[model samples]
Target chain A: MRRLSPPPTSKLVIFVVIAFFLLWWVPFSHVLPEGFPLRFGTYRTFQGSMIAMWAIVALGLNILTGYNGQISLGHSAFVAIGGYTAAILMVDYGWPFWTTIIIGGLIAGGIGFLIGVPALRLTGPYLAIATLGLALATPQILKKYDGLTHGTQGINVRPEVPASPDFIEDWFGIKLSNDEWIYFLALFIALLMLVLALNIVRSRVGRAFVAIRDSEIAAQAMGISVPRYKIIAFGISAFYGGIAGGTYAQVVGYVSPESFNFLLSINFLTTIVVGGLASILGSVLGATGLIVVPELPGIVSFIPGAGLPDELSWAFYGAALILVMIFAPYGLAGLFHRLVRVGPARVAGVLTPVQGAWLSWRERRRAPPASPGQTGAGSEDRSSGDQPGTE
Target chain B: MEEFWQQVVTGIATGSVYGLLALAIVLIYRSTSVLNFAQGEMAMLTTFVAWSILQWGEYWVMFPLVLVIAAGMGAFIERVIIRPVEGAPVLNIIIVTLGMFAILNNVATWRWGGIPKGFPAPPEIEVTGIRFMGEGALDIGPTVVSYHDLTILVFAVAIMVALYVFFQYTPLGLAMRATAQNPVASRLMGIRVGRMLTVGWALSATVGAVAGLLIAPLILLQPPMMMGVLLFAFAAAVLGGLDSPVGAVVGGLIIGVSENLVGTYTPKEWLGPDMKLTVTLLIIVVVLLIRPTGIFGRRAMRRV
Candidate 1:
């Protein structure tokens, strides 16, 4: 049977580019005249930037947890490192914002390398617990070392945050607000990192990371240096985390001990898992879902008789999480793939009866009835395991 | 010198609480290999139920009822939330638990509100005219231990021994152990593998309830009350070796004592009480560095 092949890579790239541009445009579009279509609030633009920033962290975390099979509950520590570094360099030493972000990433990556050496001795839940210890201690360490961290009050980076450059005003005939400027900066960084992640996962080093994740002894036999690649994965992942943290500093315009708490680390892990592990698309989807899903109740409240209390929002998020795990175990990415594979008509069969009937009637008329053997094969594929494709 | 002894004693009391929760963690990990991140929240929810029950009933009377409710909740969760993804990767199950963590914490906060409420400890009892458990301090050697602290210690040891006997001498316990060791073989041997797992969860939830009940009196009942304890308990469980109950308790004791000692003995200018948690965690990390499987955990062997 002939399989419907995926869209050409060039087409996929163009699609992504268009989608990303729209993501940037829609939120910032609120600056348009009152009657403009799809215009959103500045707050939405800020939220969109947050999504971009979180996606960067998710991409980094997926490299370690999804690709390399090392669980870390201490990523918040790395983020804190990056955030504090940027905050300190900008506030105290008066460094340029861009340079500080890069330096923050580099420092975080260096520390990640040091931590990864010890991490090599651990695996599975043990490694998770050890790293959790790091997360649990980070706040206290930050608070205690007030000389660097600015203690509990936290450092405000609002004054240090960069405004939109004059070049954009001259060239595009548009003046960007600070929020809009920051959003663009974050989106640019996120896109660059996303491209980097895509390449890294396809490279020889990425193969080694995957090989080791599948089996350490086998990877070793295959001539992959297990410790070295694991450490490198840690460094790369931390660098991404640091970059995201720096972005976070700019987006939120503050750096505090409480800002990079253990819950944030746990959320990062949750983002990757729910987005679809090991898939670059999954990371971005997960980040978007993490930021946007919680606000869904508020968004839906505009609908008549559909209002939900804000108190129940977290409970809704929790239920959504569990449902996602139960129904779409490979996360949103896997669900997307499944939908693409099975087509709308087949999916409709699982929906409401009236809709299913209408769709099936249309489907039957539009195309010949599928061969018996082909449909059977498709159902079998649906029942297969939850492991997301490494690609 | 007296201060050192006092810190050690105080540490033991708090450590007992950590150990109790860690024991609950180990029971589930032993059977299902899932680290229940929601353990503390489960306990917290039950303790809240106990608080609500106490409004209409006595403390001891509410205790057993709360345990039963906790057990039922545990079984329901395992069957409903956990059973479908039972064979998924460890990370997926952990995520499920994290989801449960959010749900339980949110529900408890929404239902009870976030205010700290006074939870009563087990009241003083007379066993053969010897007073046990009351509101007072007992002078022991160099330390003055609170009655509540002693009560926690007593309850911790009792639960440990009871669990030991239950797992050692009982046929059901043996079956559960068999299930943990090799579920397929246990199934072939006519053991109800699924039932054993459900029971393991029930047992764990019950143990967790006891920990929550005991700790609540000291810390005051609140939604986020158990978050800190849960982290320490996780540390204890990992430190003790996830599969070993005894290890959990010992690890808790070690962590508790060291935490207190570090806070008390460290320099006031730089590494005093404020830095105690950081220091303790550093020490735990160092220990983990030396023994990756933890001090008591058996090294896992896998075939390629």
Candidate 2:
């Protein structure tokens, strides 16, 4: 069936170029033509960059949870570590932002590797429980080391590449804020990480990760070095999370213990699940949902005692998650991929109720009608076990 | 040394609450093999229900009503939200629970503002009194254990023993165990798998509500009150082994005591009560590293 098969490579290239230009407009949104919506300028760009940061984290989570099947609810711990590391280095020693980012990612990866060692023996739920402890403790641990973490006041990183004030004359002869500069920084890194993640997942190591996920014993028997691969996957996933953290620090110019809480980790997990686990594009879509869906509460503001947006957003978000999981466990990316694989024919047949009924009627008229409730051969046998109580 | 003894007793008390919550967690895990992350929030919401009922000043009525409310809510959640995704991957189940956690917490806050409320102290606390605990306190040098702490320890132990008897001696308990062990076989054996599962959830939630009720007096009654307790209880479950009730209780006691001791001994210049959560995390890591399946949990055998 036709899927409006992704436009030709050339068209795709043009589309990407156009998108880049549009992104470039985000920082200077305040100066755009009158009556343009989403003209919050720096705020919009900041929010957009936040989506990118979340995408990076979600991509990392997808590798560990979606692909490797090792659940780490404490991913926020890795991210917090990375963010704190970068912020401290930048604030204290005045290290370059890029250096801090690399160092932070490595440090977080090292921690993840250490965690993965013990995680080797833990199954799905158990691993999650362990990580849950880690996530919950992270903020306190950071606060405990007040000498480094500044005791919850947190550290603010000075942007090494702060936008210069040049009267709109030196750079682009147009007034653009530092937010745009940071957005590109995050976007560029996100794209690079996306490519790297895709390459890693498609490579031989990726297959080993998948193998261990399906069955560690089988993977070990196949000589895949299950423990080594598990540790490596965990490290790589943490690396992405740390990178996102560093990116977040650079974008926000601040690092606080409260920023990377268990709720954040839950959001990352929700992103992966809602976007489509194990799919590259799922990360981006999930990130978008994370940022956009909360505004949904605005629609129901008319309800009495609805409270503020932040107060009620989580309820709606949770409801959305439950509904989505119940109906589309494979997430949006999987649904799209399947639709493409099945082509448009089956999809079209499922829709257009009139045609479906007419076709069935025609077939019924051409042949004798089958006995009611005994039509299908597979339906001849029903499990003797009682059905689940619907009430 | 006296301070240490007092802290140990206090830890036992706090640990008992954690133990109760951990028991609920273990029960749910036993039945469904999935961690109910929302267990704490569900309990918190119900505790609020009890709080509201108590506001009407019907103490005895509140107890049974709260249990019934919690049981109904638990059964409803299992039958509706959880049943559909029973065969899905563990991660999906985790996500659902996380969602429930968020939903329940936010809904609770919306219904009853985020401000801290003073939980009406149970009359039993005053009736039994701190004097009884003082008499039971083993006087070690200058440190005398507080009766409040002693009461908590005794309360937790009593509940654990009661649960033990219920699980070991009751036919329904045996059926529940059978269902947990093998759902298909249990179904074929004329045991209702769905009913057992719903019952497991209901019982677990009810237990968690009791934990919440007990904990509320210790902490402030607020929408976010149970978040930290839940994490600690989760740690206790892991340390004790996720599938073992006794393990949960022991793990809770150990964690609670250690938490108090660490907070007291750790230097203010270095670490404080703020960092006590790290101790729980360290225990989980150490236990997982040493025993993997937890000291009490049965080691899982994998088939390829």
Candidate 3:
């Protein structure tokens, strides 16, 4: 019998090394002609940046909904707050772009903490309803505070232009445009966020979050302050939303109440669901879906006899969500994980006849008499158990 | 004082519409335990049906026919789309409804252009002002009520009374209540729980259609016109309690009055005209904080 062991950690190390090389070299140096149309590098950079922004938000949402088992429908409100705050700071207060970005995040996180104080007492639909109200109200509030937010007219932002005298003639060796710079900045933030999120998921705090998500009562009995943890999750999630909003504002170069509508919140949540709720990589996938899918209807309009209205994009998303819930409940990330696990296990011949027999006997022993009530209870319990680490 | 009274009357008229929509929402919630986000869009579609009917006949004559069609469409939707997800997770159900929201909105837009369409008012009520305090000429006198406003108030009250009678006295209503309380028990009692649920949807659609028709004359009919009304309806539903029909009506009146009063009296610098949505949201948040189940809702006990 040939025994199979897990692949060595060195394999991961090598993969990362090669991945980084490709990420850096392929876009800028190796993969393109001198004058490629539309500049694939710039496009990739922007795409990467947008993905990073979404990943950050997804990580935050994961901590709250996935890790803490709290449902919030007002996340886009936080994003709007963050974006508007950054814009105001940069335009009105004469704050540097970076400073405004950080401040925006902190402000949003603080507001999240306040909201969470009241929200922690509520659960399920009650929480969801409260957040829904918030999402609906934020745009109105923005409109009311027109002096601050510029109301329906919206605020326009100028990209940060590098001030270098030596390279003024040759653009100071800055090959990348302002849009490219913003993209790279967003990407860097995303990478940092990804690393932090991964580390947190592996840490004690992450474990506590998972425990709480699995069973708040159980976690509480085991000495976790469930309310405190829930608030922390809210704060963390808001923090990510804030940064993402700021990044979005910078990239779009415009901020409006319409930009952060309740629809955006739904879209973000859908992204997380479609990308796989628990997986970090799923966030990236979800972001990609969010950005790319909306463009499909528009792109298809160019084809003869294939024109679709812009609103069809939303319908497509709705259909996609339904299909995903019905068939791929675990999402793309879950599917990948299952494939990874099952493929290796099957390849390694892990399941022998004796093992199969043992497993079948175990399954039989575990199976309870099937009833509608029992099935409902069983699924509920399974969901409850799976709630932790969902983000 | 005159302006205040005018605002109050206007608020009440608007509140009646919100209350009607809220009642529809409550009916659905009570029967299904699902918040129908597409309620406004559904109502809009049904109202459009009513409008199409009006194109061929008189307004009052078309009303009943529109209601029947709306009810049938509602029941059809419940059977086709909502029934399958009865056993799904709450989030999944929510997503489906959101999908419906998108689909219905787009469908309406596709059918009817984005331009607002005028809805003809019934000839029985005109826009003439009625003297409340003998045509008061005082500097600080109450505002005169318009005949149109009175008509709306009367119609709203009549609908509520009819609904109360139907729910309190009818067999179908009892079946619906039973299904809402416990579907399994209702099924065991041979109550046709699925049919009751479908009826609930049908009734809700009918009520929502009426609401849309009432409001259509005041604000021209458009694809997105229902969005703001839906928000107010949500606030009313939450305020009254998600499950109680009476609560929805009362909550709508309160929200309507308070919104108007606030708009009239609030400091110009603090809250502008747009603050109505913000205020409604604040009320919802505050109410949830104080009582998550709502004013009239009984606390639900979850089995672990």
What are the DockQ scores of the candidates, in order? 0.76, 0.67, 0.47
- The model with the greater TM-score, 1 or 3, is 1
Residue A25 CA error for candidate 1 (Å)?
3.7
The single-chain TM-score for chain B of candidate 1 is 0.97
Judging by DockQ against the true structure, name the best candidate.
Answer: 1
**How many collisions per candidate?**
0, 2, 2
lDDT of 2 by residue, A190-280 (tens): 8778777777777888888888777778888889998899999999999988998899899888888899888788778889988878766
Report the error of model 1 at residue A236, Å: 0.6
Q: How far is candidate 3 from the true structure (C-alpha RMSD, Å)?
A: 6.8
Model 1 residue A287 CA deviation in Å: 0.5
Q: State the lDDT of candidate 3 residue by residue for B55-109, as single tens digits.
A: 8898768988889998998999889888877776566666677778877777887
> Tens digits of per-residue lDDT for model 1 on B57-126?
9888998899999999999999999999898877888889988998999999999999999999899999
Worst 10 residues of 1 chain A by lDDT: A1-10
| Proportion of native contacts kept per candidate | 0.70, 0.80, 0.51
Sort by lDDT, best first: what order? 1, 2, 3
Model 1, stretches more than 4 Å misplaced?
A1-14, A17-21, A35-38, A348-378, A383-386
Residues forming the 10-long window of minimal summed lDDT in candidate 2 chain B: B126-135
Q: Which residue pairs collide in model 2, if any?
A: A1-A344, B133-B147
How displaced is residue A299 in candidate 2, in Å? 5.9
CAPRI category for model 2: medium
